[model samples]
Target chain A: MNATREELSEKGKKRRDFITLTATAMGGVLAGSIAWPLLQSMNPAADTLAESITEVNLAPILSGAALTVIWQGKPVFIRHRTQQEIAEAEDAPMSALPDPQTDKSRVLKPQWLIVTGICTHLGCVPLGQKKTEPRGEYGGWFCPCHGSHYDTSGRIRKGPAPTNMIVPPYTFVKEDLIRIGESS
Target chain B: MAKQSQNPYRHPFVRWIEHRLPIISFFEHTLKHYQVPKNLSFLWTGGFIAGFMLVVMIITGILLAMHYIPHPDHAFDSVERIMREVNFGWLIRYLHANGASLFFLVVYMHMFRSIYYGSYKSPRELLWIIGMIIFLIMMATAFLGYVLPWGQMSYWGATVITNLFTAIPWVGDSILEWLLGAPYVGAPALNKFFALHYLLPFLMFLMVFIHVWALHTNGSNNPTGVEPKTAEDTIPFHPYYTVKDLLSITAFMVIFAFFIFFAPNFFGEPENYIPADPMVTPAHIVPEWYFLPFYAILRAIPDKLGGFVAMISSILVLFALPWIDRSKVRSLTFRPISRALFWVFILDVIILGWAGAKPAEGNYIIIGQFATAYYFIHFLILVPLVSRFEKPSGLPESLSAYYKNSCHD
Candidate 1:
């Protein structure tokens, strides 16, 4: 007697296809999940690299001058304002500021305005001083939006801004240069 | 007698719940009768990819939180420690960080897919609206979570964003204080953000469930943009859609893994590694890449309140899309003018994202304002105007006709 061939119905074929596709997809997901951690393990050095403080050269910056640099992928605005700017900032009328006394409490050092350049009023990079214009009554930088003003010392002076420009901590290595990452 | 003898292994409560609820029957009904488009291709995978990314974020986030400290003093160091000491900690942190970017990428594509295919029209309106809510919540969750690191970008980014509320007329400062939990973005703010960030995802998960439910309720919009008219136009969701969605998700995972593994920091800001200091400010304080397009919009207008409104309305307009589009026909395939307008909208969005990344000056701001205007016009004016009068090409009577025509050719 001849053997009979069993024909698979369309429904059975579809079921098989569904199971196969699902298994393949799930297998891909599982593979990706496993691979991510493994790849992370291979880059053990990046962890150390990520945490280490970077050394920035401040030699090019003049006293009472500000320059911006990228550290760890964010913009670090380093302003080396001269003693004159600092003194003028201190002498500026207290009534002109939202909070005066140059708020020495906010700065790590009185000289450098180490702030994240982002505006406190919605994260825009406020325009730098316009061509030899003295830092205004608030004395430091001015945010164009809503006219929030920060003193040369990075304190909030006038306008709708809520807080002082962030003063990142730093110690001067020499008269002309400063290191941003480390402090004495 | 045999029938009366119940198996003790089968719990009486299980039987009672099953009989009362008949939840299994509902599953059977969904499986057997829920119609899905058989012609759904790989593009359909974006929704599922977004769903998968959400799950990844929640899982990795929970794990990272176990080791993370909310206190400002400990938070930065704790993140460092996780990177250096904890087993698989670096992996978890990177995945969560990069997963956020991936999630946005997939969602943007999903949103774009909806736009291109007119998936927001008519019956699918609620689904698209629910998806929009998910998008907004995701944005908030991402923003809040970004602040938890207490890094430079985190600190400055938080400061800048939290202060935007003060632009509101009256009660603005009060609202800002309420959000920060203190006068500024400091320890209290970070702690509150951490708490809220942890909580919002659970809420998002619930919203996602609603999004999916709304989607299933209306059924998925397909590439054809043509609504199904008869039984022959659709197939079972189980085998057809399930397979298609799964396949695309797998493909997306491949690309996603490539980024997670090979170049994790490619998209990240380098300055974020520095611990935040209140006194020092960073130059060019830009937001994360995902926020650039809207950021550009915010800057496009010179006026504070005007810019803010325009930026926000850019997103809010998406919710009004179903009503904005006045096309009689559903699909863009038939509408030549609408199709061209769609491409213009895509270009405008890309330009906006690009302009957002650049410094707000010169021609960039000008371009951004123009793009912003067009962005609003695309939905507010172009969609309604062009869709109404623009002539569309021929459309097939049914999915079967479309399928047969393609097969014949």
Candidate 2:
């Protein structure tokens, strides 16, 4: 451990440093070139990427009723918020929630509340998409897998979930039609 | 240099090339004359066996990959065809699959050897850390490879694991979507997993190279935990250790061959032979046998994120082991308290693995919770506290002294 090699002369050391730096730069270039193609392969296939956007008719969903639709194989909750339901979501104290988001900010229209049904905790589908299931303390979704409570605005209210449910990229095309996956 | 000139092994053409490349001299310096502590036990041979297992795995994996179709619809069918139709495909497939189990078994034994000898402490810290990294990547590689057969367990296991990521705060869903490449485990998930599974083993190969480099840097810690003081206490690696390692590898191969020829499905789930159907999850969606201990830790916790953190931390905590037990002695042979604790820790892990395979109900949960607690406590508290109070046995002066005193004991 104590043995030392013969020290390099000044010019020799400079040449060694130059070679090391040059070799490093060449290695970086080679790595990037190889990585680019490999990374590109990981992107979604064209057929699957095309299915990323889905259109749903709003006429079938009655007011206060939430309909579950499949977009990119995930359950998208499209709720036709009734006047009362809208007021209930709007009147809730935003500052008191774990993840604070105003009811208006989540939806393009006051009558619609569309969010991904997947829970923010462990990705299980929350149970309140159906009228028969428990809607938690808040009149929204409750994930039975883990006790995550979400408010009507889809903001996480209580439990281990750290944030609100995801709202997929969506836009309202007409009063009776909406599209999920492509944002306005 | 003068002695080598007289050796017949150095051919005239080779000597001519050696002047230009010095490749032969590199091998002579690194392998032939490399000095190792003379007292290393049969346990020390596990590393060599593991290296041989890696080569076996890579060759068999490449052969299996030649016929494997990564699509969800065809993966199970393709594996079946390889087993039934392709020439000697069953041998290659069994060797690769069973090789994975043997690899894990060898690695675990090697790891326990290190822990028992306190090989993770002090100057060897970085070496141990690199080993832990290799283990982490090995687990990831095995997990992804397990999914390639596209069985019922494969689909649900992928589902369960990928979903565990969603327990993360804000970016969970996006990460899950990106990982799956679709909303759920499908063709894209299978394709990317296959690519990553194929890729990680090469990374492991590079890591093994660095691991050896680090090992040679510090030489080796022997069973006596005493450093060699003179050339008399050491031997050249060329013939002594090489023969020892070769004998151990031959013994390992016999076991490996037996499994391949006689009991190909011994370590595997029968449900895995069934094609993956997302509609029907197998009653027990357990991972491979080797993953059971960590899986038990994950299920021990009731909270989703907590379980995720616990499962991950169980492995990550080993990275801290070099600093955790501030002991002067290197081997458990001298440390009475720690030696007892080490065996208890081993028993706890085995129990945890058993608990993991069983349903998480009634007594299994109780057993799991206790074992999980003991695991953390063993590392965090028992190790440090025991080192402080327990008086270690007297270490001999040298390797020669220890050999002479063996009969006296």
Candidate 3:
């Protein structure tokens, strides 16, 4: 509508449209290319990358118990979930969860649920690895820092956290051993 | 607004670039050709000076940050090493430290200039509020920066101020602990302060962008406090005001250079030279001179919560300036009683600062209470009441009329 009638020939209009479309596409590519380096810089620095791969011995963890291991300077929780904790987690309606994750889908084995202990909000480590510490109302992990309660499946059921605890790329090398960091 | 064909300075390459970007034209339109009132005084030059000082602070801050450590154990030692050994480190450090004080000096003068002229009146209310917010951010940024040195004053100041949060009822203690990141001001507090100090200048930069944008939208308020009615009353910002601003900056730098070369430690407290001693408390603890007036107001009240509220209220009171002084006349030049009262208020503030520096005991406490009372009275009662009753002098018909009258004199 801003264009004058003199410049509104069908061929001229088509040409103008093509130019605008081409320019927009080029701008998108330019913006992405410019943003690439900044995004790359945040992708875990060299020191963090060096410590990214961690091997955990699964033999030490007992049923209904969790062990925390350091991977990329973050606490990763590996729980040997008992049948009761698994049932309780399985009974949770996924639709009702703040961050919905089925207990079965979160674990590789029926008895083991491995997740990063870091809270989705503000990155404080949740506390449920020790037997003495409060496992919160959901009986999994309670973040004393801000009171985010994680269920047995590490799905955020309550408090300020917006997502389930992240499942780091991990695979069992043997029945008693596992390696974290690289996806199979 | 500039077209390629109309742009005299546009080369073929520039024309081609302008077709795509037009950045040069944007600067030309915004900065070079922007019209400002012709009768603006040296006080009006404060914005340019403040902008120049911000750039100086950023450059010096970046250089200092390169050598400074954030960790509590190494922070003091690293600063000392920078002062002693690093190349031109002493110069950069002194510039940043003294630059902060000078920044406050210019800002306070700018604020007072705004007050004397009714720059905050009417449509410029948002602009004035933004300016006050910038002042607050500057205070926060300076406080965080002070803590990075891990000096005696830095430690105690952080402790005392952060502990002020505890005056709140239910969530106070938790908030204080969260702010400190521990039971006391230690490593966690130091690290967080360093990060925030680095971040806040960028936030200030964003606020300044908005401030300038808002200023352009409304145009500047001049000494006459009259809007420019004709093209004859205004001039392009570039050659006229730019040159004047440059001259003012040159004069400022001469004083700045004197401080940098000679009496660098004059503005700084001697206690800051000592490393932060948590075990030992200094007999007298005072904030930087700029904060002294508010600090005086804090000590004036007997109750902790009352003191905290009073201190905060002093700064928050500034946001109401646009509304509080209900006068039809703009500049104090026309209002004789208000003009006299403005000076009294300034003297009251200076006295408060002096009292703040001294211990909160005996005569000093009495002085602080009186000054504090006068400060509120000046704003709450005098500004509004005086505006209602005071008879202002006759106004000039226009800026040109004032200029013509001045020429005759």
Give me the TM-scores for chain A across all models, comma-separated. Answer: 0.57, 0.78, 0.74
lDDT of 1 by residue, A1-184 (tens): 2433444466577899999999999999999999988654423234323433546677777675677775443456777777877786677776766555454665556666677665556644555543364344555666643345676766676654555666555566776456655655
Docking class of 3: incorrect
The alpha-carbon RMSD over the true interface for every model, in angstroms, is 11.8, 4.3, 14.6
Model 2 over residues B56-146: C-alpha lDDT tens digits?
8899999999999999879999999999999999999999999999999999999999999988877899999999989999999999999
Question: Candidate 2 versus the native: TM-score?
Answer: 0.77
What value of lDDT does candidate 2 attain over all alpha carbons? 0.85
For all predicted structures, in order, the TM-scores are 0.72, 0.77, 0.69
Which residue pairs in model 2 clash with each other?
none
The residue pairs found clashing in candidate 3 are none
Query: lDDT: which is higher, 1 or 3?
Result: 3
Please, what are the lDDT tens digits per residue for candidate 1 over residues B125-225? Answer: 88888889989999999999988888888887887778778778787766776676554566767887898899998998999888877877878777677
Order of candidate numbers by lDDT, starting with the best:
2, 3, 1
Give candidate 3 regions above 4 Å deviation: A1-184, B1-9, B406-409
Candidate 1 has what TM-score?
Answer: 0.72
**Model number 2 iRMSD:** 4.3
Tell how far residue B234 is off in model 3, in angstroms.
1.1
Candidates' C-alpha lDDT? 0.76, 0.85, 0.83
Model 3: per-residue Cα lDDT over B53-88, one tens digit each: 888898899999999999879999999999999999
Best by DockQ: 2
